[model samples]
Target: MHSRKPFYLLVALLFISGLAASIYRGIEHNVPFLPGKQVQSWAVDAKVRFQATGEPAEVSFSLPEDPAYEVLVENATSPGYGLSITSDEEGRRAIWSIRQARGQQDLYYKVTLIPTGVKQILATEEPATPEPYSWPATEQAAAEQAIEEVWSRSATNLSFAQQLNKALTASERSQNIELLLSSNRPAQLFVRMLNSKGIPAQAVSGLFLEDQRRRQQLVTFVEVYHDGQWHLFNPVDGSQGRPDNLLIWDRSGKSTLDVIGGINSQVNFSMLQDTRSALATSIDVMMNNDALDFSLYQLPLEEQSLFKGILLIPIGVLMVVFLRVIIGIKTSGTFMPVLIALAFIQTTLLTGLIGFLLIVAFGLTIRSYLSKLNLLLISRISAVIIVVIGIIGLFTLLSYKFGLSEGLTITFFPMIILAWTIERMSILWEEEGAKEVFVQGGGSLFVATLAYLAMSASWVQHWVFNFLGIHLVILAMVLLMGQYTGYKLLELRRFKPLAGE
Candidate 1:
């Protein structure tokens, strides 16, 4: 039955674990705070009304040129109101009017706009487009001419041109012209050329799908205001400066184009001005809300005050397991050393270790001298405790005198543990000699240092805090330590002669 205790404990834990999982899933999936699917788009209704004193009020309504599929004006009821559809210098407008209300009369008009297309328009601006020009027939002559023209251009006006001239000249002279032209950097040179010629041009960063492979294309599109309309120009492919196969933006509307630069290629282009989807935003908010709710429930009230202290337990346990199972370090009690180490974490390891050692050493020294008095073990321990306290007081006073308040505070040093260690060390010193006592005391301090390091590690703290499920990590460590059947390092050293066979 004693041997079956662990099995029953494990079974009970498993049942509780399954229960917790089911509860979590139920809450996370069913609750509004938890993340589910995203809401894709929003339906908006906008209405505008106008009233004039004597004359008929003229009002216009226009919709965004974005290709939203569902847009309608519904329940637009205004008695004795005039409505007209008109085309203006701008694309289109709906005109309506209502007589002035004596007091405050309500007019009802509802216009609904729903997004129809996958791609949304982002921006619109009018750009100057330049005429198409061809490069020299041969690649070599074109490269040379491009370099010369770029270098002769005005420095103030064509900075990009000058830089491109230097780069192209170096590449051509080295016979690496193909490598340079194949890259997207040359698009900047194209932009410089258009800008120098008084055509508004800029380089655009976007992904391009090609027949063989998908590539990132940095193309320069020139916007020219000509013939009372804005046009787009692409000099790289000699596209005759048209907006048809180019994505360009001006003050007017966002435009996107799909182009197939190579022969026998089909390209499709789409644009989205508003990058974020409503569903994605909603899902993010839900996930955050759920996480906060889970945190509020998972943390226990009693442990909340010493939350940081409780967090150090796994690290301390790991150190204890490593010392006992791997290194075979023996201290006074199981887990007592880990608890002591945690106490050390409150006051750093170095200061804690130094203070601990000093107090223990002073108490043990006093204990040995008082052993000549032939007192009982309890009385002897009591006397040692008094001496330890006196030594702590002296140490505190000395620290203050030396302006070391930080160091002195550690002198308080869990007095009970210090007194017990002193008694144990004195016995070991007397019976087992100085070496055994030093080894055990030093081992305890070494274990404490390891625990301190593990507790302080940022990654350990992050994992433990973010995933309270990491208590499973501690359980896993416990299981691994239980199954460790190998000989300890100390045992190997002591039994070295057995290995010689």
Candidate 2:
């Protein structure tokens, strides 16, 4: 029992060290996703300088056409005169100026570049053409042409297809559509049919009314330009296709009365397209932002490999503590049983347990039989060692003969530990009784099995891996265990009669 104090002290120290290390890692050692071979952009203000000796150098500056209006070029010269200009990319520039220099004097110019916004556009499509058309009539004509084009390409004359396609193609110059079908949402069928004929169409997933209750449904909508307005089509029930129900809200954010298309007929209308409200668009933006944020910190090289397993050691230690201090299990060689259990983690609990039990059982039987020969203690252990080797050799031969390569790996099962355990158990059997030896051996195995289970639990793995700080939870557990002075559960069972008095 006095020896047990050192074990408890060792456990306490380990707990404190683990707690400190985890906290240090959480605060000081951040495992960030460091930027690799990827391009990153930032907006900055810098001064531009140019020099021309005998002849003036022709310098031209350009900026990305955006809403912020921050691009400014200070100095520009043709033949020793300063010039300034402001225009858009289609027009001229926000601000461009020129400075004149003759003899090798450096001209100082400042440019302020501001970021308006960044958009990730698919590379599959070419840049949109910037062409303006007359309002009202132009918009009406374009809408009609787009609808006609879509109708001509579509295989189904269903009212839903006609209305949806017409709306989708209305703003051909501004809108691009890709069609996809999803079995989960039948409404996508209409979208796919329209897209098959070269109409830009896609299935939209959102909540729609079904049977008077608000429920999730996929709606097929199309982009349309009408009356100088770009709108998304919301077609009501018709021979083509119609959703069971629809909800509407005006531009003022007021909810409009629910539109319940008659079983036979539905309303045909268009809505303004807001990419911000699109689920897919929003998800893509979030993923990209998170990816970029992660690509900023560097993690340790050595930790990169062992990080996962190292995080799980706390649970393994907890299992060891629970077995020793709570369940009152006996094990030979402090932590050797847990280490064996860790080896089992590599092979898996069921197979490892079975293999270990079989090997130890066979080795113990050989050791017991040799004990009848009156061999010396060391000689008896050595004889058991030889028998264990022979058993491993036999197992390997049988595994190879039967094409069970898995069994061959168990041949490497820490033969020395097996020999030592058998020798110890034999001593216990002789000095105390077979029951005492069996109880202790069984207790060690029980501890190992518990350790195995704790290490393999998914939630345990996830929490330990994601939030290293949570290791303090394990530390707290150890601290609580340290103060536990009550008899262990097994000891309570043994002392029950005394307590009953």
List TM-score per model, in order: 0.45, 0.42
lDDT of 1: 0.54
Residue 174 displacement (Å), model 2: 28
> What does candidate 1's lDDT look like per residue over 350-436, in tens digits?
778788877877787788898889999889888887888888898888888999866776753677777778888888889999999
Query: Across residues 51-81, which tens digit of lDDT does each residue of candidate 2 receive?
Result: 3443433333332232222232233323444
Candidate 1 at residue 183, lDDT? 45
What value of lDDT does candidate 2 attain over all alpha carbons?
A: 0.50
Residues forming the 10-long window of minimal summed lDDT in candidate 1: 257-266
Candidate 2 local Cα displacement, residue 248, angstroms: 27
The superposed Cα distance between candidate 1 and the true structure at residue 342, in angstroms, equals: 2.2
| Highest-scoring model, TM-score | 1
Q: What lDDT does candidate 1 reach at residue 318?
A: 79
Best by lDDT: 1
